[model samples]
Target: MGSGQSAPTERVFHNEIPISFSQDLVNRLEDNLSTPDTTPERQNTLDNHVRARIQAELARLQAEEVHVREQIEAVLERENLDREKALSGAGAGETEGGREDTTSGNVSSSALLQGDLEEVQKKVERFHVRRQLDNHPKVKDARDAVLQCYQAKTNTPLDCIDSVEQFKRSVAEMERQFVDSLRR
Candidate 1:
């Protein structure tokens, strides 16, 4: 049971039992048990030392957290500025005057961060549905003409050719206007 010792390390007889540990473990146990920290003065001193160490560590961690927060805030402010500049079309994907506006002087970081991105967010939301009908009435009239021509000339479809071409041209014009608005 114990590395096949020549002599039994532990002996137990009936209800009485004895344990034997290695020399190093026995010495460490004795050293811990025989410490003079049992006195009230030493015990109080040890407790105070532990408390001081804990407080110090907590202060260090709080300082580190403050530093990290400042860094994150700085980064957020910078990113907000970049987004504001891009959305305003000041640079329009050009990085030449990105660091500071040469013509308009230096833009304040606070001003950039002041926007809650509400305008930019609204524009982004509208971008997906930007193809709203600007001249819906005209397109609808052309489409109705094409449909009516197809209905009237079901037998000779070639007779509806002019109406179909008119409808296509109207739709093409609407698309062109939509594209132009996006450029602005």
Candidate 2:
């Protein structure tokens, strides 16, 4: 022992564990730890499940699309059939009361009646105006008669022809129409 120093520091001992270990011990401890599951395997399983669900939804939507298309096609086909039936003159041969709408045939008759009524009304009006201009005292009475005749024939008042010139012009036009019709 050295002078003035204790013979030796008392040695300490512990049985729980050593403060440091060998490199091999640490390596062995790490190797004994359980490994985690593989990332690729777990990912693959999840991907397959997602893919199946997506495929099912796609199939369902596709079926709905097909159904909608079928309904549209059906409506279009019905419209086409109706169009074909109408274009083929299917309604032409159908008869009612021994006739199929003679409205077109009555046009000539109606025109003739209209022409006769107009001509008669024009003659009555011409006579009335001529009588009025001839210094007749019954001008008012003649005018009233002309007005009644015009209203009865045309279902219109005599307000359109306020002068003899207008009436003459109307008569000339009517005569020209009649002449043309005769020529035709």
Candidate 3:
């Protein structure tokens, strides 16, 4: 009413009087015109019917989804098994003097062996310094001496050791030397 709008037309049916009352009267008039049976039991029954229908549909969809997932997993497992069998037959022809039918199996096995050889080569390259340590007399002597010192210090029980601090310092120095040697 404050917006300066014209008032709404009052709706009346079947020989009724015009309503010049408040908004609540319009609501009541509309409710009465709609239906006579607005009981709590009827409302609850409608709600329960809709809820049951939705629940049944949800269960049907879930079962279909589970069936599809199981089929996909089975197909994947079969493919993996076939691939593994092929890889195992890779070296058969070479071992049998080129007489075996090594198609997929031979190829996959050879590929796996090649991968293993490359990894071993990489490890050898990384440990080149450590592998050469055996040929150096000075490095070997120092390593043995440090290990001996550590073994002697840590050999006794804590209560039996007189100077725990001195032992700890010596052990720490030996550990530092071991790490420095590894770097070289």
Candidate 4:
């Protein structure tokens, strides 16, 4: 910059919330909806699920925001490196009239960026979500309890407190197990 003072640097913030948590939450909601029985609890659950989904979506957006900022930082770093190379090259290749030529440096940097973009596009084309295949029987039992309570206490969803607690415990236990497995 031509200014005497330096410009402020951009700061990127990262959220440590695992995206998998939201993914599993969505999967469980879908599983619950797969049941044939319709009850008032299901409606309430659906409403709650919708709210959860909105929150999950917000989290996903935040992740994307972080990713974009990281990409921008990477591009800026590359540009700085390219600028340094170009300046050095221009100095070495100065003409009799003191004109600096940087065509080669500019071309090479643009080509490098193009190659990177193409490689990224190729990887993106091959991307797919990995879905969990196994369903734990313990979780199945807890889901049944919640489902039963929903059917029985259609008028008063608060009656499903015990079942809901059990379901929460089961899911939390399963999530712990899943994370532990990944560590191994």
What does each candidate score in C-alpha RMSD? Answer: 19.4, 24.7, 21.4, 46.7
lDDT (Cα, tens digit) per residue for candidate 1, span 1-184: 8568776778766745577789999998898799845668878998999999999999999999999999999998988777656655655233453433422334444454445366568667667556466547778899999899989888998998888888899889888877876765
- Candidate 1's displacement at residue 177, Å, is 0.8
Ten consecutive residues with minimal summed lDDT in candidate 1? 97-106
Q: Tens digit of lDDT per residue, candidate 3, span 1-184?
A: 5554576768767747665778999898889789777679888999999999999999999999999999999998888667767545553344343334435533444665676678679767767755564455544555555566567767554543434454455556655655776564
In model 4, which runs have C-alpha deviations exceeding 4 angstroms? 1-134
- What C-alpha lDDT, on a 0 to 100 scale, does residue 94 get in candidate 3? 49
Off by over 4 Å in 2: 1-38, 90-184
lDDT of every model, 2 decimals: 0.74, 0.60, 0.65, 0.74
- Which residue pairs in candidate 1 have backbone atoms (N, alpha carbon, C) closer than 3 angstroms, thus clashing? none
Error of 3 at 47 (Å): 1.5
Worst 10-residue lDDT window, candidate 4: 125-134
Displacement of the residue 149 alpha carbon in candidate 1, Å: 0.6
Total backbone clashes of model 3? Answer: 3
Q: Using TM-score, give the best candidate's number.
A: 1
Comparing 1 with 3 on TM-score, the higher-scoring candidate is: 1
